[model samples]
Target: MSSSTATTAPPATTPTTITSPSPSSSSQQPKPKTKLKLKIRRAVAPADVAATTALINAAFRADDTTDVYLGAEHERISLATEESVLGSMTATDIAVFVGVVSKAAAVDYEGEELEHKEEEEEEIVGHFWLQKKSDTLAWLALLAVSVKGQGQGWGSQLVAHAEQVARDEWKAQRLEFDVVNTRSTLRRWYEKRGFVPTGRAKPFAYELHPDWEGVLRADLEFLYYGKDL
Candidate 1:
């Protein structure tokens, strides 16, 4: 759950625009809006491992613009896999939740729409890990959302869901997580959500992968953030 490449917080949701047709147009057709339905629930083992792995990898590796500015060797890489996801799910203290999204059927749909039913298949768009560190503490980690779902607020929902579970269900007094030191924007996003710096940090666990020695930033560290329930 902890990694220098992990995205601790999600960026703000991008605003969606619904454009209207010009008043002078003969066929004044407005843009059709598709309503997306999101569902969050505990991830089932085996069934969710592959999808969750893909979601995490896609999200963590989505942005690499900083690599060019820093150096080619400073790129972040995601190493999530079905085996690792399944192994994590085996832990009794860790609970993973997945956010699934599907297109809502149109209210005025007719038989013609049935042909596109395949396109309506629900997709696993986001996921997060909530580990019960102790009776009064919980740790949040591995939060991620698919690139397609990034601007839709699914990530925030996942974090909120984790907080509620940790505070109410687990009766935890506080929640905490680690973010890469260089991710100032992400840290600020968490701060806006009531998390603050704990003035503690740990070296990135590069030993997890030998190849990461040269690929990841040599000075990378994880800065802690916490919130009281």
Candidate 2:
């Protein structure tokens, strides 16, 4: 789910909900109500760097669909190093948001168990970055959620938050992003979220710097997409 050139995703179906019977019904039937507890806020100081890096790597590694694309490009599961994560935090144009889930809603990532005390604390399960591209446009990059965090509607919530920040805080009229051209499933996922292909594309070569960890390959290219805020 990271357009940061690390991971891919399959198309996700919309969540289904069943309505409860009227509260006043005479039949002795009732349904319990519960609310999801998700906290979305700016990632904390330097401490967040390690957690974010680990989450992104875990998410991409557990997703086979993601590997199909990244592996072909000879890319590593991790797109960000601790240094890069911390570096982005200080940039004025980039904002990183981390989604912290309540313990009640937490699930073991990829079936990996945590000690009882560890499971009691809230977990940072998802993250994304918003870059102010220009006065009227913003771009979202490296959006990812841990393996167990997906399908819980948290991804959509993060996207919505990005759109709101672009419009309300940045005064931007549009939000843009790019995806590996080969990941049709991911493209369709964004399509459902109101993004449309813009007919613009760019090479996804990981040669942005000599120290970058992602491998450079000829098959990688990014296809651009955008949404009106």
Candidate 3:
């Protein structure tokens, strides 16, 4: 199936807890604080194709124990290659956004860098594609976040950024996407972000991939979800 036809499952939501330090533990050493920054921007072809493709495949890898089955041996339900990413980048109606994460450096009072600086590190942790479907409608697809990046609200950030671009840049009045019907968790995640089911669905186009001979559930279908901008 084309990446546009499906979306990767959303990151699992985890609750946050806060605790106060006890007076008896005042002697404990303070741990170093590290802050991470996320930047979401339109991807550039060739330069971002490989990294974007790898991140998508890594994030979309299927879990046989939980995901709707494709086969025991197949680790991924959808895969993206450099060529495929480049193709999307070149499409006039499509725009791809990538989320990059890096450790934020602290500045001294004099506006100079700290001597104990951490090495410059960055990673492409998440990505999604937006396609202009009509003058007032756009489609979101291929949303994925790496395993390490999950549970940190990065996926939500990507979705929010995409919606802004769709509305401000594309002049779209609505945005929509399809999720596998079996993925109730993923659907609910989107619902929390203001998307609601459109009461529409279509059969998963497994027949399109002749090489995929794995057994699939007979009732698998893509459920439409949408939000008005």
Candidate 4:
């Protein structure tokens, strides 16, 4: 299959528990279900910035799952504190490139609202903030889902949407992203979606990449996943 097409699938078809249930619900026998939908957009307007930031930050906190991506936090959620939130916003625009469907869109959403949505109604529960590094290469900078919508397959859809964006908008030949080499759980998820390891890694500069940190260590080379579009 072409890499572009391959990228349009979930890193894993089936979902599994990546993190322990929240402490507030620890006493409950089973977790309550959360309704989730994820829709991707090529355009994120300046008006949508704050809400987008909120969603992105919430998603980032939830993404501390299984330490699979080797981000800023370990053994706990990083975005809960103020420092991490500031860090994430600094590294990225948090508004322009990636975000979940805004409440405004979902509340009043109809067939005509988004022409793309009318064609493909994969409601956005999460988003992967992408950046074009070059004409031939693109960066999967951030992948996040809303805190309330964690279990309803938003992660997979966002990943799929990233590839679609690559094909539809960027026309990328290969979609590339970095993940911690030690993060087998997340890596497995990406593998199921068709990403393969390139065995390349270097120290991630937290100062430059504020959303992420040195937790992965410079010694921990990220495995590069490339899908030929």
lDDT of each: 0.63, 0.62, 0.63, 0.49
Task: After superposing candidate 3 on the true structure, give the runs of residues whose Cα lies further than 4 Å from its correct spot.
Answer: 1-35, 62-64, 70-78, 103-121
For residues 1-229, what per-residue lDDT tens digits would candidate 2 score against the true structure? 2223232221111000000101111222222133244689998666787998787666554534332334433554445567666655656667889888755446433334435555466678778878787899987877886555455667788889989999999999999877767556667778888999999977654555444344333465677899999
Model 2, total clashes: 0
**Ranking according to TM-score, highest score first:** 1, 3, 2, 4
Location of the lowest summed lDDT over 10 successive residues in candidate 2: 13-22
- The local lDDT score (0 to 100) that residue 194 gets in candidate 2 is 92
Please provide, for model 4 over 1-229, each residue's C-alpha lDDT reduced to its tens digit, 9 standing for 90 to 100.
0123212222211111222212212122222343335546643443344554465555544544434444444632333223332333334322123435554444332223433444432233454455566787766745655555544565777777777877787777788777755556667777888988877754433444345453433444456777777
Q: Please list all clashing residue pairs in model 3, or write none if there are none.
A: none
Ranking by lDDT: 1, 3, 2, 4
Q: Model 4, poorest ten-residue lDDT window? A: 6-15
Instruction: For candidate 2, report its TM-score.
Output: 0.72
lDDT accuracy of residue 47 in candidate 2: 75
Q: Which pairs clash in the backbone of model 1?
A: none
| Tens digit of per-residue lDDT, candidate 3, span 1-229 | 1233233222111000000011111122222243234688888745687888777765555333333555545544445667667767766667878888553321211333444546655567778888788999988888887655444566788889989999999899999888877766676778988999999977666566444346455566777889999
Q: How well does model 4 score by local distance difference test?
A: 0.49
Candidate 4 stretches greater than 4 Å from native: 1-37, 63-125, 206-221
